[model samples]
Target: MTGSLWRRALAEALGTGLLVTVVVGSGIAAAELSPGDTGLQLLENAFATALGLAVLILMLGPVSGAHFNPVVSAVDCWFGQRHGGGLAVRDLAAYVPAQVLGAIAGAVLANLMFGEQAVSWSTSDRSAGHLWIGETVATAGLILLIFSLARSGRSAAAPAAVGAYIGAAYWFTSSTSFANPAVTIGRAFSDTFAGIAPGSVPGFVVFQVIGAVVGAVLVLVLYPTAGDAADEVVVPHTESGVTS
Candidate 1:
């Protein structure tokens, strides 16, 4: 993590902001383009998200490890501290806030772009036991995929693998796979097809956190001797004397 903290944080913020922009904006566009066809709309939205996430990760991997999600950052920090080559606690502190703020800004930007109020709280009530379970499963699987890649030194595949996984999870999980906490909060600002009601956020976040814990435990159990130097969410590079 040789990149300056400010630089890394900026990359996280920008990357996350753009990620949310793609998500909410695409959802809006999908709904508009595919009117009554829920399946088509989902397909459209999922494709956009998968492609966009892959590109973002590739673009920002060297800058901040592209940890747009808080759970990823936390897990990275925990692993890095134990193995001596991951994010520091201070880095985690900086990354989470940046990711959250960027996510909010992205949502607002999406709303404004779609000709809606900037801060319209969503009315979509996604509060149900089944939905919570879906979120938990979605998030847990995401963590497992990411950390497992790190453990196996296959981080280069993350862009495609992660993208593909999320695309699949969107359909497999009932809650449409809002596996990211930052993204969850961001969605609360939009009252569109992708938005989640503010009231339902807490439960979703709690479940996601539980899912993260479950994923970490699974990692330990499944890969008992996995290296501590698990790959960052984004693969770092040093081609021009810059690193993350």
Candidate 2:
């Protein structure tokens, strides 16, 4: 395998593992420690989840573009940067399993340490109203934020920005702003404080995908190249794609 591929895989696994762990762990801490007040629980745990995501993105982005989420990866593939294949087949490699396992591990850890068992959703079954809207808003913000950082070559700060967006999104967006489809779906399996109900995962993911598409479209329209003054990120694919 190419070194790039290995690096990407490692980044995906390690970065996602740490990210999920923080999300699940801190959420649990909030639930068990805060208890009665849902708002307090979410508020207290938001920081660590954000910080952890920030750190992981900084560590893994240059390696694997720090996709961490399948939606990010899928979009990359769609735009011709990532190697595309059957969604079901390709996801098995590193993207899907890693994310799922990471989420599960995070949930288990949260349960063991903090005793959280479920994430608060806008509604039961994730039926696409509030959750879909929240996911879209949150994801659009996240992808746009990513585009800004990646193009500007300020990739190092991407994680922190992402973390801040997500942390703030908790209070700002309904459905706790589960912007990443992979994360939204995976969280369903858990019964911990961070868990979304198993049945509701699909709607959250669909909305996230829609939001990311919107964000990416805006990026394409604005930049259309690498050296464009309009673009803040300098992702590898954009180097030869164009120059503003």
Off by over 4 Å in 2: 1-4, 81-93, 114-125, 226-244
Error (Å) of candidate 1 at residue 131 is 0.8
Clashing pairs in 1: none
Best by lDDT: 1
Q: lDDT score, residue 234, model 2? A: 17
Error of 1 at 115 (Å): 1.3
Reference-based lDDT, each prediction? 0.86, 0.64
Off by over 4 Å in 1: 1-3, 237-244
Give lDDT: candidate 2, residue 53: 78
- Give one digit per residue, the lDDT tens place, for model 2 in 1-244: 3454555565566666666667767776787788899878888878778878777766555555567786666555554442222122343366656765666555555455554444333223556587688888888877777666665676556666778888899889888877876666556655667777767877777788899898778767765542232222312222222223
Error of 2 at 160 (Å): 1.8
